[model samples]
Target: MSARLYVGLMSGTSMDGIDCALARCDERGTTLLATYEHPIPPATKQRIVEISRPGDNEIERMGALDRELGHLFAKATLSLLSKEQVPSTEICAIGSHGQTIRHHPPSSHQPSEQGFTLQIGDPNTIAQSTGITTVADFRRRDIAVGGEGAPLAPAFHAAAFAKAGHTRAIVNIGGIANVSLLHSEGQVLGFDTGPGNTLLDHWINRQLGQAYDKDGQWSAAGSIRPDLLARLLEHDYLSQSGPRSTGKEVFNLAWLDECLADLSSPATPQEVQSTLAEFSAESIARGIAQCEVPVSEVYVCGGGARNSDLMRRLAAKLGTATLETTASLGIEPEWVEAAAFAWLAWRSMAQLAGNIPAVTGAQEEVILGGIYPGARPRTQ
Candidate 1:
């Protein structure tokens, strides 16, 4: 089979922007061709944050925002295609990892409830606007068959990074960090490693009115509060075994404030940010240590990979293991997640399983996402 063009669209927990990646994939492998970041206005981001938590008139807000995002995504896709001078008709499909608003895992606090996740961006609107087959709503099917319905990037990490005799780990630090442990013996295991940039970003945003602590500069200027770091580390979620996952729902401002309330003395904003950075690094290191077999190399990806101070903290925590970005493997750190979704779309079109049962605790491997045919589609 020949490689076909596919575009993957992602709006992560940060709500910073939408990542759009263009890739060509076939039986041989996948290649990253180009990429784009579509900005999200402050108003849109605030509304998204509001919708993430409970509030009145949610359905109305959610409905309008969902369609709004769809249009945004389509515009971004078309913009990318135009820049590359590639017509929509030449594209095979679009894999959209729409913004995740709420994620309730079965393993977490919600025991009796069937775990569910909601990522809203109308795929129908995307397909209609872009004239490309769209594959979306990728998490629910995994949840339906007894899974966390998350950490979907592990499946892609295994495919793209794993080698026959090398045991490696791929850690993607978005709002929520997730680690993929690829055993040399061919088994893939992983789970979310607590809050990634969620605490750090939110803390800085509140204190200095900055979008984020660029390169971890603000946190670097502060001192780590030992008592506070210890308190954050004691979180119950850290002890949970695999097949587990989490989201902002459990690690938001409320949770952070609750932790702060337990402190002996009030912490300065910078100190709190410093403690949160260490807390993020520790949770990630602890998660990797849980791998049944030791990981020889640690490959980092996502927005957090660009934070020098966080990377230094992680290096010390992960001592001896080689630390580097996915760029070593040909894909830039920022593009990995978007590329993964594009790869997943190709898998869906091929009727191949995209979820790893062992990694997600699914009953079996299954092809993820629902397919929305393009404007010109009639035959499969």
Candidate 2:
């Protein structure tokens, strides 16, 4: 059977850029076809960061940014197809993960009868601009049915990487870190580990005006501040022992400033950067350790896999189970999330369920994402 083509667009919490991936999806599995990276305009990124936190006129700011992002995502999809010399008509659909602004899952600490998670990048605009069906708004349905509605990637990860007789942990360190514990016995477990690159990226931008620390060199150069690391590690979220999810709403610059407020001595920029890396590494390691099955090997993905210093720290914290990029398993670290979204789009189009209840703590598995049909071809 000929494989169907699909496009996946993802703009993670880092707010760096949009990742557009082309994949050939079928019953056998999904195969990545082509990929493109479109930088998010600095102004647009700043606007997104601003509205992520509590602010006045949120409706206005968010409404505008959503349409802006939709145009960008459409441009990214068209750009990818043009570069590959392919026609948009050939693509089955576009899976747009959109930009997540706030995600508040129902929990004992913060109970909500009407829990909601919002991601915006107008799928209508995407469909109109690209003339291709778009699948988006993927998380809220799971949330509506009494689930975390975040960390939806684990279900895709489990499907892509699990192998019989071996247990593997897929750790994706985006703005926030999450791990998929894949067991040979077909049990899949996952949750957010807290604070990946968001703190590091914010600190560097504040102190050095750089988007992010290159290879985590600045962080590696400084010594870890024991007190700061301990305090950050003690965050209440880290102590929780069940399904969880978080985003910029809970781990932004404001949260970091609050953590530093009680410190006896203010830490230098470099020290704080180092502590952030250590904190992320420790939180990831701790999450992996808590899995019901011992992971014999841990595969890293997302932008974090490219940070050498962070990888070194992760290795030191893991201490034995091989730590390597997802490339070892035939998937490049950077493209895994985008590819997963492509697969999700395939699932959506096939009318198959996408969310995994075991991973998201949902009452049942459900098909995620709302579909917007492509426009009809022009007549002669």
lDDT of 1 at 362: 90
Give the alpha carbon lDDT tens digit for every residue of 122-184 in model 2.
999999889999999999889878888978998888778888898899999999999999887
Residue 362, model 1: Cα distance from true site in angstroms: 1.1
Output the lDDT of residue 168, model 1: 93
Model 1 regions lying over 4 Å from their true place: 1-3, 109-111, 376-380
TM-score of each: 0.97, 0.97
Q: How many pairs collide in each candidate, listed in order?
A: 0, 0
Which candidate wins on lDDT? Answer: 1
Candidate 2, poorest ten consecutive residues by summed lDDT: 107-116
Query: How far does residue 174 in candidate 2 sit from its true spot (Å)?
Result: 0.6
lDDT of 1 by residue, 91-119 (tens): 89999999899998677645666778899
Displacement of the residue 273 alpha carbon in candidate 1, Å: 0.7
